[model samples]
Target: MTDIHPTAIVETGAAIGENVRVGPYSTVGPNVRLADNVVLESHVVVAGHTEVGAGTHIFPFASIGHKPQDLKYAGEETRLLIGKNNQIREHVTMNPGTSGGGGLTRVGDNGLFMMGSHVGHDCKVGNFAILANNATLAGHVELADHVILGGLSAVRQWTRIGTGAIVGGMTGVEFDVIPFGSVIGDRARLAGLNLIGLKRKEFPREQIHALRAAYRDLFDTEDGTLRARAEAVAETAADQPLVKMVTDFILEKDDRRFCTPRSGE
Candidate 1:
């Protein structure tokens, strides 16, 4: 029961499931597999060794599964794996991985890629994440579950954005962003805990309070020794979920760099 526009080109080797729709002038290349209920709007292009899960909708002019733009790609076999129920808006471009970086770019279920967004090679995007309009993630970036990248925000290569973190509009993130924290500005200062986001996600009030206190102790001091403060806070606030999130984020090392509080602490 799939519908394919006359002008659209689907390679014979492609595997398209039931109820899928391919709009005008779209193209599905060989080795591409789209599960049931997926929709590819006008001018969409899905190529390479890519697989789109069920119920994913890719809007007009979105180019997915394209070879990595990295110079080191050298025509190696790479893959782009997108999970179910994702909404990839117009003009968004997602590149597959490079052999130099594990040969895979993966996106989890229920993610939203707003218009003009670009996800570079080797990135791993988590479930329910939101990439606002024009947001750009460079190569090797990892975005955890429920993280929000505001409009026009740009994250540098190899940076890890923790779960539930929020990067405000126009921010430039060069380092790892702590879980549940709000970051803003060019160098990305730690504004505070993402209380509004946590509240919206229905996190309890007591957990929010503990996180706020932990944030204060971790970032408010002149010494700004986040590790020690985080350890102490973790020992005292162990029972709080929010506290555990903060402590784990501080302790986890991404690409050998810990999340550092903004300078001038």
Candidate 2:
């Protein structure tokens, strides 16, 4: 019982699953596949070899699965794979992958892409993330679970944002943001833990306390490299899971500089 408006265009060979609705003037391309209970509001265009998962709702003027904006893209076959229960709002653009980027762009489940947000080619955005209005992710960026990009924030190409990080409004992130870090300023710097989010998600209070102490020890000290300080904390707070996660992320094989707290804070 898929209900598609007469004015909408479902190209031949497109796959629309049960209980889906394609609204007025929307277009589903030949290579598009909409899973069960998907809803495309008016004027949405889903193109390319895209597979939108079940229970996703896309609003008007969303341009999904378009060709990558990369100048290096020479029209090779690429794909955008979106997971379940995402809310993609008006004027959001999610481009397909490019050959140079391994030919796939992946979005995990339960994301909220607000108005005018753009996910660049080859980005891997993780589950439970929120990209606020006008937030932009450059090509090949990887966002770990529960990351939140505030309005007008942007990340440079190839940067990896760790789990539970928050990039504040108008910030430009040029480095890797640590998990649970709150970053701000035009050129981003880590401010502190995202305490609100961590509390809302019900992270263990004792572990949060340990992470705060470790944050002060790791970043506040001028004595050691970040990895070295994190290693020390890992040894001391080794029983704390959050501390271990922070240390592991610090020691992981990442190319970008780790975001550090401002000198005073």
| Top lDDT hit | 2
Q: Looking at model 2, how many pairs of residues clash?
A: 0
TM-scores of the candidates are: 0.95, 0.97
Q: Which pairs clash in model 2?
A: none
Candidate 1 local lDDT, 46-128, one digit each (tens): 99999999999999999999888898789998999999999999999999999878999999999999999999999999999
Residue-wise lDDT of candidate 2 within 39-129, one digit each (tens)? 9999999999999999999999999999999999999999999999999999999998999999999999999999999999999999998
Maximum-TM-score candidate: 2
